[model samples]
Target: MNWMEDGMTSIPNVLLQNYKRLQIEEKEMMVLLHIYSFTQKGISFPSFEDLAERMTISSSDCAACVKKMIQKQVVAIEQGDQTGYEFYSLKPLWNKIAALFESDARGQSLQQAMTAEKDLYSLFEEEFGRPLSAIECETLALWIDQDEHDPSVIKAALREAVMSMKLNFRYIDRILFEWKKQGIKTVDQAREQGRKFRKPTGTEQVTRSENAVPFYNWLEQ
Candidate 1:
């Protein structure tokens, strides 16, 4: 038999990554690994003396650590039906670890969403070429938080305002309102509406001032 194979124990990556989150201290975690190793070698209920021999802790201290694990509901001792013998069970510990991973993923997702929403103000400041006023900032927040407007749609409205050379909060607000009224929920829908609105009628001439770009009169709409 290989010397490496005889000594190896398989520990989960999540156990190492999130042991602190589980409130397990360094010494306590070592005890858990020892317990897992013992279980793997067919020693389910290893005595505290056995655990203490492998670790720096005293047998009494090892017993205390086992008590703590029991209180935390991570490990339990159950009686075997055939032999009437007690052994350690790690089912609860694995369940807790799984729940922690799911909770962390949800927290990260929510944090990312909040970061995107917070960046909306900076985007407006960059386009307007100046810092927004307190009132102007409040209005922008209302559009997202209160009115439930999509950030992409708000950005689309900003682009429309820039093209029209209006460059003001009122014009941008008007564009948003018109899009809402027209049931435009996406950038594609907004672009289609813009094309239709700007299309010239048969009676109108194609000529335009050399200094001006063609844009829809959103205020008139």
Candidate 2:
């Protein structure tokens, strides 16, 4: 309808892929798009009123939208060099979108990892002879999700607890804690550590499956 520049303004492809998924409203998108347009046309840091007037939105609404965009990590503010003007940087938005794709492409691996986690959960329940408590489940989830512990390492810790007649989550957690202190994060590494220590295997290999009240010594240590 109107003739201004012959070329199109360049928006990052990452933004195009993930704007809606980030819960950005149309007004917010328009705000970012307008800022991008201003940047491309060499117009710097137009006031909120400038944006509101152009978009026919209220000034407060424009400000709120920009704030929401910033909260959602889709916009950033940068101080202009000695111009007393600020710019909205879109780099974080682009980076977040790129991370989303990187995560998506690993969907297959994530599913496989989930399967391994299910197997680990089942192994614990079977060995314990009861469904895990809510607190226990949350603890295991934290070990997997927050601590990023390997399933094999967890299994080894569980096996160690079983062999030591501990048969409790706390003791298993302690074993993991001790292993982490030694940087033993894998079954192979743990096994190698065991060989390096070469302690007496006869006393620690008893496979106690009987239900018993767990001791707090491990936690104390």
Candidate 3:
């Protein structure tokens, strides 16, 4: 029976129909859906291992499917000696597929998009109280776009690190490294550590005055 007879009028079906016109399998439909979902979310395209995990299939199977899609010209795969594989949709074909499923007028206005990005930058400056370095700014932008990590958790860690270490970026880096080594990615871990360090012990009470010297002076002594 024809796919239309089966009443499956989804984007994937449209994509499959396009591929079949070029003599490809309907199974490519599933792989295209997976790729569309991944890219639509603005995440870094998944690695082969990631695709395997998400699809609950073996890596070899995932690789085979990818190769077939590439061969069929429904997907494009780029490989770099250093950077590994990147997958991009054949945009013309995908657009046609999407148009079949729904109207294509769902894009954002340029002004609204720019305003949102500007707001994020403003928030970043307020949180850090200084302009982000280029690399830091790029990292935050990627995080915001992908929604991969929690901004609150990152902000709390930054705040605790700054407060505890007197805003020394080097010390903050060290603290972040240690937390990462311990698999502490959330804010609560940093807060708990800060609380522990701030607790007044008898030794701390007795030696507080003596240890109040500047870090450089203490180092010199």
Candidate 4:
């Protein structure tokens, strides 16, 4: 039996469908799909230990599986100086594989749509100084794929958050939501607001709140 038939026999039909569309090795595919599940729920990428626990395998075996996946172009791996392995999806390859199983007319359109969205995300990252988190990247990708949001405005906000505020993903998201509530959608407007927020307020007080005391500062019982 072929890989597809084997997959159908061994794995659930819903999972098998996702696996086929990604064209990844069975072990790697299973782990990747599980990781993808966490992403769908707004969690960032899973760690090596997390992957090992989920797969019910040793860390070494999980490492090997991940390495093989990196080789297969199903996932991209980044090793940090102090931090460890970071995995990201190889969306282009997955999109191509997905297109192959779709109707010919729809396949071409879907392929084009995926490619365009990827290009737009590349532009977003380029405009921003640093890489986005997995959740942020996936959110942008989904929005672009659906063509429901303005890429230019989103890119501008991302750039403003990265450049003006010393903001991470959480802070950036907060600023984005605040801007949205205030009906500030354009890049220029975001940049202007960022500039205003960044200016030092001479009279601003650094008052400590009631919860500001450290754990060690609390009196012993």
RMSD of each: 5.4, 10.6, 17.8, 22.5
Task: Estimate the lDDT of model 1.
Answer: 0.85
**Candidates' lDDT values, in order?**
0.85, 0.81, 0.60, 0.60
lDDT of each residue in 129-218, candidate 4, tens digit only: 567779878777654445344455555555555555554556655655687777776666666676676554544423334334342211
Q: Per-residue lDDT tens digits of candidate 1, residues 1-221?
A: 68876878999998999889889888889999999999999999999999999999999999999899889888899999999999999998999999997998999988986887778778899999899999999989988888778887888888788877898999989988888888988777887897787776554534544335655533232
Winner on TM-score between 1 and 4 is 1
What's the C-alpha lDDT at position 56 in model 2? 78
* Ranking of all predicted structures according to lDDT, beginning with the best and ending with the worst: 1, 2, 4, 3
**Candidate 3 Cα lDDT to native:** 0.60
Query: What stretches of model 2 exceed 4 Å from their correct place?
Result: 1-7, 81-84, 112-221
**Tens-digit per-residue lDDT, 122-197, candidate 3:** 7657766888898777765665456434455445545655456565445544655576666766666656665676
Highest TM-score: which candidate?
Answer: 1
Q: Which candidate has the highest lDDT of all? A: 1
What TM-score does each of the candidates earn?
Answer: 0.67, 0.47, 0.33, 0.33
- Tens digits of lDDT, candidate 2, 183-217: 98878888877566544345454433243345432
lDDT of 1 at 64: 91
Instruction: Supply candidate 4's per-residue lDDT for 194.
Output: 60
Stretches of model 1 off by over 4 angstroms after superposition: 2-7, 41-50, 76-87, 95-107, 177-221
